[model samples]
Target: MDLDKVSFNGQIVDMTEDEDTMAVEAHVRALVLLEDALKKKEWLLLDREIEYEKSQELDPNCPFLHQQLVLNLFHKLQEVQLLKNGDSAGKTYVYPNPDSVNIFLGQSFWESKEYLEQWSRPGTLILAASQILGYRNVAGTLTASDIYAAFETWMNHNGIYKNGIYTCCGEALRDSVCKESSMSHSLLPYMNEFDETDLKKATLDILWDCQKKCLLVEHIEKPQALLAIPEFPIITTSLVQELIEKLKQVKFKCDTRADKIAYTDPRTRNIIYVGNHFWKQKDYLSCGSRLGTIILYVAQLLEHPHLFDGATKDITSETTVEHQGSNSPRSFQEPLNESIHNHDRDPPLPLKNSTPSNIGDALFNKSKSETYGKCKHTADTICAAFEKWMSHKGSYENESYTCCMETARHSVCNKSVMRSCLSELESRLKDFV
Candidate 1:
């Protein structure tokens, strides 16, 4: 009935009558106003819109607008999940707009990311102030110690982000953010969520620069070629190194450490790569040769159906269906190119049919010579022992069959000492045969 309710769900109301139609126009107007306020980071106005919309939302449209509103309120946390729509690929689509990737953060942080190329940014500085000092409101009054304490609380609240930075910049920005944290002295108890937004924002600032400017247009495709994303993980060394010099233009570090965010890094143990599988550790966690496998899969999807099961395999085979694009195993419609084994081969000639001089006799004779102890006899001494060993199995025995075992020496005897043991029984058997 009002401007707010209509914006969230004016479409759902039947506007057949004149009064309802007037309400619909106001609803549309309200949504446009809401969208503009969100862009301005105007939370008060945005909150008002949400309150008005939520009071009467009995349908899906209201929830849709509400979700967008909530995300706008927390957009700083969102720079990490690129291309999240149902295949439109969002802003991270690498092929056509490969140069268009953007990390959503403020300009100061963006400038800081650009500045880090030449030097390290004070992570501890932010940790102390934005997160640690807990004194952004009383900014000038907080002592350095209090700030450090607050930063630790912040870091504790977040995951292990001693240096929560990995922008599009090509270099590493880690110069040690602090001399130390309160974790050492206990001035402030650690908070687990102190890493609210600055580090991620700072990292994005660097990322936007590297993605658009630092990484040369030519080199960009190669790194983006790694298609598999294991756990919304961080950037790669190749990405870091290639753009580091360009990032120098922005002052960002290339491979500076950050928590795996998706999981704890075993190397850093900040829960980097935590729930992620071990198979993709090299490909996704860092840039490596295996990432080519991802592109190969895409090729499989488009070019070579025979190369993939299509139904069973993932965009990346090890990437579970739940994790990647797949929802479930597809019904295998057709056999993937008939199996080479299906036609079968000469049935391996049954072990029972194997000659006494070959695998069967070899296994039999070898066992007998060892069990019966040493016997410095002729080739038949070994042969007879092998035949005796095989005699238990009707399949292994035959009138023409011979024994298999032999001591280490060329002699077929079982008692041959280690010193006399010269070569493998099969090799030694050739001379006797």
Candidate 2:
């Protein structure tokens, strides 16, 4: 039986006598070695390049002195997930390390800079990269704690911490080398405590400086409160402004010779613009383009949910033309009962339990005096027409609701005469409906 194998590797060899006892004894020895390694902070026990030779003479009892024993427990080391990768090998845990944080920030900024600058939005990428480095806020927005956490995790992952305690000056380092004592492995004690707001501000300042260096990072808030992530699918007041700026840049302009006033995108036909001179043409497009759509969604997500509501033509041009043709109905009027006599004969008695002038009759009387011709009327006129149509069936009999058929101002009625008068009325009614 190889006692060396059982003792060093902490594995019990199958034996005829006292097998359980042997296993217990081996396990106890393995615990002692692990505790010793823990005290020295040599947690990278599974690293292939462990310094066995240097520690063998210096510390005869060091667990690493027996390389075979460490290798034998490779399965156990893997089970614990402490097997160090190339970059993490020989690293130490040092939370809140500034230099490590700076390195990560530098790398992330350069990687995401192009995409951010192309869309001119910066907040999102910075926030996502920070999260990847272990600084995360639950609300999907950047916060101070997230920044600090990211830095700390990056420093630890990169093995930037010292292994022993040190004074404010050089004395502690000298003692660590001479005595071979454990070092201060944590930077949390030395780190200056900062509130969430201050930490957030510091993070912003760092990003702001990156922006000034012509890096694509940007903060949209006026005072630079947060980084601008332009690709994020959310709506904000600032995002709306960015979209408007892009639209304005592509706004169509014509020379003096052009007679028809129209707005169109000169570069691309993706957007649709419609409106008159009194109203600025509202730009319309599917919110699918990465650069444009995200900003629109952002505007809706933020404070301007109504930003895209009125930008497009609700009714098609075909419908507008159909309503304006010669075949179009002259005016909207409620059907009168054929049984009721015309003005040439006396009227019949009111229906059972019905008044001489019911609500329907009163409403019809109000609508009879109004006209909806080629000219557009206010909402009030449309409302009056609807109220009468909704009420009295017989009230429009005597009232002439005819519109001007000629395409010019009527000589006697003094109303604009146009074949499109019926279409205008329909359009106004549809709008109200």
Candidate 3:
């Protein structure tokens, strides 16, 4: 066969008939076509069609016919700048780190044989770049501009250009870095602590902050209360307000209906008696009265030691008994012996099955009949409110539940014991219902 000849920069060179020489020539020809296609921004031309074209001119059986071989050959060409020597008058481009370039191009090739096949579609490049940069640590010393420039060059060479592509690329890169940094350092500690819902919320919040503020990953603040154990049946100002409103409703019911109920019945009379004493306290609506005193009364009524342990805060004279450290919920069944009245014959009977309306009527009659009393409407509201509060499902049904829990965890109860106690109190109330 006549010795084959190939042209480089218009210089015709004789090629030997050796198979190795043909392979080298094929490799060189492939590189030439690749560089031309890149310079002209012909992405489609770099696909398998071009490979078949090279195979026609050179030996189809050559080892360098595969795409991987083409990539390896490209890497060698870039390393030696052999192609740049072929163009004395062409502009010299400053290449980024060869490894980054390989990654960028290698990803483009392995992921899709066509250079811009997938990337040419909107947002695909940015999405791929974000995932790669965020999840994988392949962006060594590559700035947003560096990646953008590489992408721009690639696209420009393929005769494709868009106005906001650079900005989008930069944003994607920035977000990826921020996400990786935040997740790895700031949020990592609390990640395991959060349940699925909380984790999702926290992650979305962090991502929002990163994208919206363009914050540095290190600058992203850890979510507040992420590590803190949340208080069950969280108490809130709204919750307290709701409780107070409910109390007012109970008082209204009592004031309007006291005359209708027969006071001779033990259950009916006890409801009125306990309700009467509850409404008599001066601090009936006070935090100590509502949260502490009422909680204590319920514990006393239920005879639950766990409730008493959790609810025993000094709210009124009736709740004078101090909490003795008891492990069992059954240990403290006896009601506190203190009296809300000086002339009391017997402590009012526990209204375990009494309705809120009955308790309200009792409160109204007690307030009307009593001349002097220390703990008045406080106890009444406690009983009435407990009935109403527990009648619904768990505390989660209350609109104020979340806010109260957050408040308890973040502000009101700093100690875990206090939170546990409050939780215990709420649990007992639910069980009582």
The lDDT leader among the candidates is 3
TM-score of each: 0.14, 0.14, 0.15
Estimate the lDDT of model 2: 0.23
lDDT tens digits, residues 204-246, model 1?
A: 3333433332221222222222222111112223433433333
lDDT of each: 0.22, 0.23, 0.25
List the lowest-lDDT window of 10 residues for candidate 2: 318-327
Show how many residue pairs clash in every candidate, following the order shown: 52, 23, 24
TM-score sort, best first? 3, 2, 1
Shift in Å, residue 196, candidate 2: 38
Looking at candidate 1, the ten consecutive residues that score lowest on lDDT are 263-272
Q: Candidate 3's residue-wise lDDT over 1-433, tens digit each?
A: 2111121233322223542243334334334543433332221112232433343232111111223323443454444311211222322122222222211111121222222221321112222221222211122221222222222222222112245222212222111111111011111111122332332233233223222322111110221221233322222233233333332222111222122111111111211112233333323222323223333333233222221221233334433333200111211111111110112122222224223232222222223133112212333333323222221222333333342442211112122333343444445445444
Report the Cα lDDT for residue 105, model 1: 17
Candidate 3 — worst ten consecutive residues by lDDT sum?
A: 179-188
TM-score of 1: 0.14
Error at 351, model 3, angstroms: 12
> What ranges in model 3 sit over 4 Å off?
1-234, 237-241, 252-276, 284-433
Q: For residue 223, what is the lDDT in candidate 2?
A: 17
